[model samples]
Target chain A: MTERLTLALDAMGGDHAPAMVVRGAEIARTRYPQVDFIFFGRESEISPLLDRMKKLKAVSRIVHTDEAVSSDDRPSVALRNRRSSSMRMALDSVKEGAAKATISAGNTGALMAMAKFVLKTLPGVDRPAIASFFPTLRGETVMLDLGANVQCDARNLVQFTVMGNAFARSVLGIKEPTYGLLNVGSEELKGHEILHEARQELSGLNLPGRFHGFVEGDDITKGTVDVVVTDGFTGNVALKTAEGTAKLYTEFLRGTFRSSLLASIGYLLARPAMRKLLKRVDPRRYNGAVFLGLNGITVKSHGGTDALGFAHAIGVAVDLARNGCLETMGRDFKAVDRSTPDEPAQAAAV
Target chain B: MTERLTLALDAMGGDHAPAMVVRGAEIARTRYPQVDFIFFGRESEISPLLDRMKKLKAVSRIVHTDEAVSSDDRPSVALRNRRSSSMRMALDSVKEGAAKATISAGNTGALMAMAKFVLKTLPGVDRPAIASFFPTLRGETVMLDLGANVQCDARNLVQFTVMGNAFARSVLGIKEPTYGLLNVGSEELKGHEILHEARQELSGLNLPGRFHGFVEGDDITKGTVDVVVTDGFTGNVALKTAEGTAKLYTEFLRGTFRSSLLASIGYLLARPAMRKLLKRVDPRRYNGAVFLGLNGITVKSHGGTDALGFAHAIGVAVDLARNGCLETMGRDFKAVDRSTPDEPAQAAAV
Candidate 1:
């Protein structure tokens, strides 16, 4: 527990890049004092920012990489051409055992492709899933396959369930998490054929977490389960829809506060309370999207996030790394893979 | 436009049942003075409720039906056995041309099933889609296939686009409404094979509204397009996710307002402005889910909505009937059917 953990940061990634990465490392250093960093980017750009933060500079070193993956680069194009890019190099650090994890805010597709190529998937996992925690009424729920595998089979969903369960136990510190498959309805007869196959497979397995069967999209915000597993297509849409609704709500509040003199006065009086609520539901708190089921940990930060948000992403990587989430998933999924030896009911394959 | 329109009501449906139906009809009577209602349920229950509202009784007549579709009844069970159900009678009225449309707050599956069997789909439409309008930043956006078809092919998606476009123009009064296919990403090559096929088909067709290509889930609330088309599964999940997020925001607001005495005073002063915001985003304002592509209009109200919400649903049916939405859709689909005669690229069939 006292051992120092090193995290690789893609210093040239995101909107604010090197500055945000350096400042974020400084903020994270205070919270996780045992954590160190390897910043990957052009030293000329990163060095200046690091020089301003002595605390981060003390435990961090720069790995020079002139090339960086552009935000618009496709996964295949980035993987083939941008081999020496900051994002790829950062992931390489994790593969090379120079760091416990990698954190990046670059192109999501490029990051995923590079991470998979460099670190590889765990023994029992067919694909890596993007897992993130969402704030709900009761607490937080971790949903996986946010946008990784668009066309997931029953096996992929089961693997996601295993990965998400491992995530909850390792990072969230839940002794035994409860998981559910995200569907249009909670009925046993709901959703695609693959979902039913996945449910049947999960029901047969003696997993660490309890399987709650099918749950609707509303169950994510209701905190009905610790983990919600879904295909990347639906997960991505659901996540974005929730984000959009939240933004719309904020806009409505702003318009309300500006409508009249009394409302303006009211906003001023309620500023303190409103600040507390804002902090509680702040997107920055949930900025990190963890690439689960990989041999090495990789966290994707929101591209437009500030230093504080990047720091949150760093904390997520640190938590997953420290808790040995990869190993936990490996062990749990090994048992599942043994029980379910054949992947016969692959609807997509048919 | 000057003709008096009649809407059939499933008076024994919903959580509130005959009482809410009678009250809602009274409210709608005031709004649409030329609209009349034929209440289908037990006359003993309907007569007593209508007696309390003289205005509703003046323009409405009760059609006694002993049987009613239970909330828990499966679609197949309801369709086979519940032949004399109030919901069935309501649809029957529409088929008999006794009512211009049917308004039901009953089981959604049962309503859709009965409506399809009684009224049938419009010519050239293989399946009907659930269409609803969402409150968006720019105004309102019409989205289709909310929960009707769990699995849809490219042809189904193209048909949904057609229905949604007609809905926007005829009901929402949007001239040349722009539409987008909901996908994981806005990129050209993002989602499943079906999405690609659907996009290709939409692109080639000379649609009533302009096709804006793929749109992410967030675009729905952003009002990026006037209409959105997706399979029922994804659409249902996204819609529910947005609703859940909205509910969470309200809970957060309530918690903030009750956190301190200053906040309580602020809330009192801000009540008027908050009311305005609430009214604008009210679920009641968007209560009706229309079954598009049907030969006749069928509006389904939220089963748990109050009198006001039910009244809003009635308004939806009235609007659709008055605007000849079914005929408009029929005309639009006829052109699409002629152009896209062969459904050769149906991935689901393969």
Candidate 2:
């Protein structure tokens, strides 16, 4: 018999918490049969839901924490007051080795703060970065620093590249993932001082993944590289912009299909094709945002995602733990010399 | 009779230049009979193309210049050596008051450098920014600093807000255009220090347009604000990401429809509806990117765009010149006090 892996769940997190979390756990239990869950939330609320899910109840145990972190709670406020909150307890489980990983759809800022505080950064990592995969023309590509560190220096970016590279290898199953620094243009002279310095260092790195030099915003969706590295601010903006544009185009198509009777009939015929297209670009399929460079595996689901989306988030956490992504990341970091290189004088001059 | 407005054109610029330039001019002539053109390039190449366009020949004058700026030339290199290039000569026409505006489908960096040198910035403006419109669910929204100033201070952002507001009013025809500063989040505590300071200054401005405070990246396509103000780096990345995402979705739809015979027939039935959707999101419809804050109205067309796209770019120049967008921008800048406010000590602390 295969050894069962334990996972931590923040049952009181997200928009439709407790119910969605319990249902999602039930679904995940069937999908990942070798996995067990430790639910952290109010026992009164979770016990009734667990009673309804027979399979989930057999493999899960409730921690019984009434305190929960609100979606609007500031990271600092949550950190100071919400020690017994579901989100914090979930992270504590990971830190204590009670769970291999933790999954939550809670306040992002608060989650990041508590996870960083409890789990700490991995050896040789200065900070943790939010990493997620998005659909592209060729396939899916992983992007990092979604909104963790707003203003990153050259060193921070280089570290993100290392973490993102490891992620693509372990999670995406790419033998030699190609990575690129996100910039205004691919030209050498373009972008700011930090980017130039980061480029120089990245170009010289001897790693499993190849650095493909600079890529623009469009390259993210074009699948120009396996990993796209950027500061938190630009990455966040670019990700959101892509989401908004996808929504806008989808709305336009819907409006066109409803304009006339003939068009409506056409839509009926094309419904199968449209469903395939929708499944390919569904946001729920890409729900989990992994906080890379952390010592423990922490996956964040979208606060507004549904039960299926939450189940997918749990799947991501299971995959990471099963594949030993944190161990692989640690090995990758150990391989690199983390000593800060002499800052290129020309970089400062620019 | 309406006073005729003249637009300078760089006939030797873009991927399919000289031919596309002349053909686009022909289309523009029929669209706006009141607009005249001065084509700058090698007369031998342009004259023959003009001969094929009879209507364009009647209203356009060709300037003889063998020198042309190559697409690969660096901005500084082009500025220093390509003095008599078609791009430079076209700007010279605007500088000499022979044309109200100039449009070119050429190297963006080279064009910006030449245009700035020739036309200079408006009285109270410190830098010129690239502004363009994108289709939104509500209608069309304007975004500025597409890729002009990479590293902008708080003051530059405030200036962009002023310029963007004026462009929306004069060109987009919005009387009281609402504007917002683009950020990672809408919260006051989010984003970098510069964004916070910029927000503070913009909130205090008693301008014609209402400041809608901070807006996230998704707001750009949702049409949350009429004008989205951002530093050039973020704006450019967001714009390109949207374009890339749109292409990705379109490709997915095409692939899905081609997967089976039934889907192919369904595509045929939906062709008319798809055509309508295509026309609405057609990139050619939004070809022009105006360089705001310049004394002259300068427009940049995508280098890879076809004749129709170039024609739309020319149309943008004509509209800006006819609406007195530059003059209105000048008045708006003059109305705002240019003095730097005392830096909030808290801004430095952050």
Q: Model 2: runs farther than 4 Å from truth?
A: A186-189, A338-350, B186-189, B338-350
What is the Cα-based TM-score of model 1? 0.96
Supply candidate 1's per-residue lDDT for A325: 88
The number of clashing residue pairs in each candidate reads 0, 0
**For model 2, how does the per-residue alpha-carbon lDDT over B1-350 read when each residue is reduced to its tens digit?**
88999999999999999899888988888999988899999998999888888888989999989999998899999999999999999999999999888999999999999999999999878989999998998899999999998989998999999999998999889999999999997231389889889999988887786899888889999999999999989998998999999989889888977987777777787788889898888888999999999989899999988889999999999889878898888888877754335434544678
Residue-level lDDT for B236 in candidate 2: 88
lDDT per residue, candidate 1, B1-350, as tens digits? Answer: 68999999999988999899889998899999999899999999899888888888889999998999998888889899999999999999899999999999989988988899999988878999988988889989998889999999998998899999989999989889999999987231389989889999899998876899999999999999999999999999998898889889899999999999999999999999989987887888999999999999899998999889999999999999999888888899878766764555563479
Put down candidate 1 lDDT per residue, A195-312, tens digits, no spaces: 9999998998888869999989899999999999999999999999998888888888999999999999999999999999888878899999999988999999998999999999
